[model samples]
Target chain A: MVSITSSRLVRGREARRAAPALERPGVAWAIPGLVFFILFAIVPMAGVVYLSLTRWDGLSTPQFTGLHNWWRFFSDGQILQSTLVTAVLLVGNILVQAPISILLGVWSAGYQRNRAVLSTIFFFPLLLSTAATAVMWRQLLDPNFGIPPKLADLLGGNTDLLGGQKGAIACLIVVTSWQFIPFHTLIYQGAARAIPLTLYQAAAIDGAGRVRQFFHITLPQLRNSIITSTTFMVVGGLTAFDIVLLLTNGGPGTDTSILPFAMYQTAFRTYDYGYASVIASFLLLLATGASLLLVKISGYDKMTSTMEGL
Target chain B: MRRRRNVVAGFAAFAWLLVIGVPLYALVNTAIQPESKYTDGGPVSIPSAVTLDNFRTVIHSGFLHYVWNTVLVAALTVAIVLLLGVPISYAVVRGRGWMTRGVFRLFLLGLAVPSQAVIIPLFLLINRLGLYDSLWGIALPTAAFALPVSVLVLSGGMRDISASLYEAMALDGARPARILVNLVIPLSRSSIATTCVFTALQAWNGFLFPLIMTQSNDTKLVPLGLYNFVSQYGGNVPALLAAVLMSAVPILIVYLFARRALVMGLMGAGGK
Candidate 1:
């Protein structure tokens, strides 16, 4: 009996060892991709870290600076301001947009009959490039010929929505929120739909109204989804580019200069690659830290289980 | 009570439609309005004159190259993503080992690290590879960045297949490689298609990578191309709007056709 069991185990191990290379006709195609990612992604990332310490001007040899760039980032008020701007956008995005999206998502999901149409319309903005959305909304907020001015005119005031800091920032907030809400709504709707109908029936039997049911049942069930959407929103808001680049370009006195744009301006426009890399490193650290926190807080294990089931 | 509930639901649906529809109406209306009446008229009023002049000018503004470039980039990126992501996903899903776990963690780290985080490094790397101003640079990075989501979706789909299928194949003397092609690929077709659509849209309309990576007109995608129009022809609202419309039409068509699949993929993977 011992000899037989040992032979079976050896056969099992042999089968396992042979499984991967045994007969995948399509496996050969993946080799090119493996090489591509290795060379382009993995290798270049190393070069970035290495070159960040050295000064290179796109042509000449790089000279090592040894944390001088990081020191400059601290002393340089502009880079600091850019970080602050990105943070402000993050805070504003979560504070202003998330709640409305949740409400709309819940409200829209409750009425499933029209969901296909309404959801499509809501997602329409997403189809447009950020450049196009920027242009459309920019035209709509044109201090002279735009929609906001027209509304302001009717309200008996002359306000330039894209001119001042408050107006410009507000317009950006509104446009970004408008552009992004459909994404969160889709997430929220999917989660809301996934909640077993029996939960709502039980809540109804308990005499809970729609609003109460939402708070007690829907919100709790959607906790994972809320965390997921929040993670995306925070990351996206922190690294916003296209909308700001087209509409404001951090204009009217450098008001909207977020970290990504600032990094770009520093490196390419000004040719200060070392300083730009310093800023880039900090941004990467912050984004990575936030993502880690998101995964921790959201119970990634549970989400993964749910995903696997689906 | 049933009748009352229907009325309420109807009213709510109408409200939803109003909020969504008006903005769309405004986008189309403003885009079609003639240039002469652009700023002088009421924002809510009907266009004084509708013309294809904007479309004509946009087509004439050398934006056709951008449209073609975007298509090429989005297509090639999707192809590369599938080529790489499918096997890795299959391996990770099927194999139970530290190596698989390690590979997965690498992708998860990638998920946490958005392309924006590595834009600076990516730029330097592209410059070094002599692909800085070329289309391949954007295609490669976009595919790399898209790998995490693609793997997530594809692996999720793959995991749903029963162990018995693999067992049966193994008993029949089929190798993992053969099973992947004959069984896995055929079964996961929808998932793969869905992944392709979402990744394509993401690549086509992506802003940041193309913004920093490519500087010249030869490799500019539609998004960058539209930005250039604003710089060259800001006051020409009709031309700019035309360019915007042209860039949006193709993606809009895809969205209309594959709306459910694309949204399902996003909600299943990244949207979640």
Candidate 2:
């Protein structure tokens, strides 16, 4: 009993919908990527776990010594300290970077005239590798010639930034934020643009001020992007190696030495592949567990734009 | 209300600009200055003498060769990611049953795995393959790590193609391959670009792989080269900063010429 006027429209849609089975690729199409990914990614994941149980140098075959490295890893005071430092760096980075990225992301999403120019300037940091950013800051953090001495009083006369644990950690966060905020901001910018202007206009009519509109409207609208950006931050923070290596070298008697650095120092410097693999295994678990937690909590796996229902 | 809000936002933006700009300004200002004068004025002061000597020093130190190796790695990485990521994404989007869905989940799981965590085993694997100290060794694992993101972004793009478009192609008797060639690829152009840009950046800017898998100067990528520069130059701040700037040149050129495409590609990684 379709209306006569809509009969043609219905028929056309029906004609198109009936062709679902056409051009469906088989499971074989996925084999190449699967094989490659498994060979490189999955195999290594399993290998790290296996290596944790073995004693081996780079030059020799691994000897199976069940849970010996694990036992040592737990007892090791440095590992605990490194774990604490890693946690602090991770939390500090998020605290510093997330709000800055969200604010900049929202601000840059405006249709104002200078947004594009400012964005391009902001995009400069992303162009530089973490190595370069760290190196440049290393020079700038130099007590005599860098910004530290010039602003010695503001820093409470602590010009030796990389010397103290707290200062070193602060420097690491600032550097990490500087290098990475632009990327997350870009993510938020895209999400912010997808938000409807009508929502704001409607809120205005309800006597909501701009700040209220942002709190009630823009913040809620950016929920998914917030999750996405924070997820990246977590994964990146867990495996943070380069900046730590370049900027601090896990210095001041390994006080700033996070897990990855400790693992590298064990494997390459001390040639203790077995213990290194223990740290590696711990890193693998932490990274995957944290990401899984974030995904589960944020419902990020069910990724849809905030505007999906609208 | 609008005016006042704009004022606050503007002031914040200005302050942020300085935060971003000052470091960059310091980087450039220091790079052009001769090493002797760098400490006299410190990082903030205008250079007493602007010279290309720092850049010259970088070039002479085999910057171009390292750049070439990096380019090779970036190219190989982009090629591998696209060749593998596109088909799998297509299969994930259109193919039926549990296998494809599981594969998608595997990649989602992989999004958590970082290259550093796997480097020890990756080192052993690369050694077992007899590819240690080779560019191929670095490129292979780098591509592998980038695959999850590649698949995620590409599949996101492929899903946007209206079912009607696929049906139209099917109605025209197009097989899966032909439909992929004729319809899917064209529609997925932006995603492919995103994949290309992202993977290229991953490879180009990669550090840990090259650090562990390849040690020799011949195989050293740019970031690794920069690592060496820190030791070799030894407090030659101007020369070191110049090298850092050089490491960014190729991608910076891409960023300058193809900014919109590069930006859109980065935005695509937002997984919307």
Candidate 3:
């Protein structure tokens, strides 16, 4: 029996060795994709950096301005306010959306029953276009004829949830979180489901309660996913554009203007392309820095051993 | 204890239902209600009078044309992404040495650069290429953006194909092209489907590119159309909601059919 097994293994090796040799495919196959990547992504990214150093409107030839745009970006009051608003949104996402999504994810994972229905309901908002979501919320929050104001009136408080400056940022955060919580929840759900059943069983056998088991096992296990989702949310919140643009147009007097909206207004609405590029570059650095920090915290090595496909 | 836990879980689920269901209910309910009812009744009130007149008004005002433009752009983007992403992923999977790894890393860099940061330059490039205000302009960049994730997912799919299968095909003297067609393409169907849905979603929902690159009415996509509709008819809530619902239906149908694959793909990418 040993001889037979050895002979079979030897024969398999021989067959593999005797296979017809074809030249291994080369990097030329990646050329077409790389061409498109270079033109559409790489060159354009480089152009933003270049444009930040030059003064150019859409119609005229660009003039080199030697860091004037950068200086202006640092000192500009409106840009600074937009940055503050973006920071608030990021904090709100981390504080509100992250914990809620994690709770929902863990709950659904543990419960098992109705998990499908629950996840479907939560993920429904992710399917809608940001523009559609913005429009839906805009109508729903209209002060004169909307639900929030009406509900507030019924409760004996008079306020404009979306139309007033003080409430606009909070409203933006709520709408943004409403739209994105599902995405984070899905990520957390994936992580929660991946926890070994044996771990939970062992904890249960040790007389640990459900909450104790979750605190001991689930939260630690979910660290990576939480970090990943936080990165997505932070970067997303900082660069939020469409919803803010459509919902308020950075409105109630620029109170809801995040960085991307500010950048858009600078470029398209005001035709200040150079200054817009400065904001764009700043945002790019901020997103890249935040992502790198999270990735490091999560210990995500890009060339993972699994990628070697051994 | 178990019964109490069940009650809590049930309550949590119910709370979630109300949270998500109410907004969706508002969307559909507002869409179907007559304009007068929308104006007169509270925003959350159930409509006494239901009508498709708002939808008819939206359709007559060339909403369908914008939908078609968006569909065309999305289809073309998916086509281009599949055409380019598949071969590139296969090559990245099979090719030896550092160059292939370098190329893969190059594509991965695309994920870090948001479209907003680069739209100004993209606008300039599109204008320079004389493709500005064309569907191709939107489709091309959107496809470019989609390629990294597509390639990542496809390569992950390709990696799952056993080494023995490749060896057997090679022993049969099958060329690389045949192996790609017969082996890679057939095996990677799920990945391709996932990539297609993802790319389609990106293109269909894309606002920034269409907003910046295209100027003509002929080039208007659905999101832009919705934006313009709101700006032009700010008072007509029902008509606006009707338009939103109309635009959301096709994607909702796609999601209903492919929710599992879509969710799995997104989760996988996000986790990675």
Q: Where is model 1 more than 4 Å wrong at Cα?
A: A1-35, A153-158, A299-310, B1-19, B265-268
Best by DockQ: 2
* Per-residue lDDT over B1-272 for candidate 1, one digit per residue giving the tens place of the 0 to 100 score: 11125465457657756656666677677678787875556555678888888887887777888899999999999998998989987877776656666666666666666676577678877777898888888998999888877877787778777777887886776656678898899988987987898788878879888888898888888888888888788898767777777788887777778777767755646553
**Superposition error at B74 for model 1 (Å):** 0.9
The local distance difference test score of each candidate is 0.75, 0.87, 0.83
- Top-TM-score structure, candidate number: 2
The lDDT leader among the candidates is 2
Where is model 3 more than 4 Å wrong at Cα? Answer: A1-22, A110-113, A153-156, A294-310, B1-4, B265-268
DockQ each: 0.47, 0.62, 0.57
Candidate 1 lDDT, A1-310, residue by residue in tens: 9966886686578778765443333334344545666665566556556667877676677789887776777898887777777887788888877886787677667655565667667777777777888987776777677676657757467557667776777778888887888878888887777888899888888888777988999899988888888988887876787788889888767888888888778777888777777777777777778788776786543324333545
lDDT of 2 at B140: 93
Tens-digit per-residue lDDT, A172-257, candidate 2: 99999999999998998888998988898788889999889889999999987888788788878988999999999998779899
The residue-level lDDT of candidate 1 at B12 comes to: 61
Q: Number of clashes in every candidate structure?
A: 2, 0, 0
Q: Which candidate, 2 or 3, has the higher DockQ?
A: 2
Candidate 2 has an fnat equal to 0.75
Q: What's the residue-level lDDT of B221 in candidate 2?
A: 89
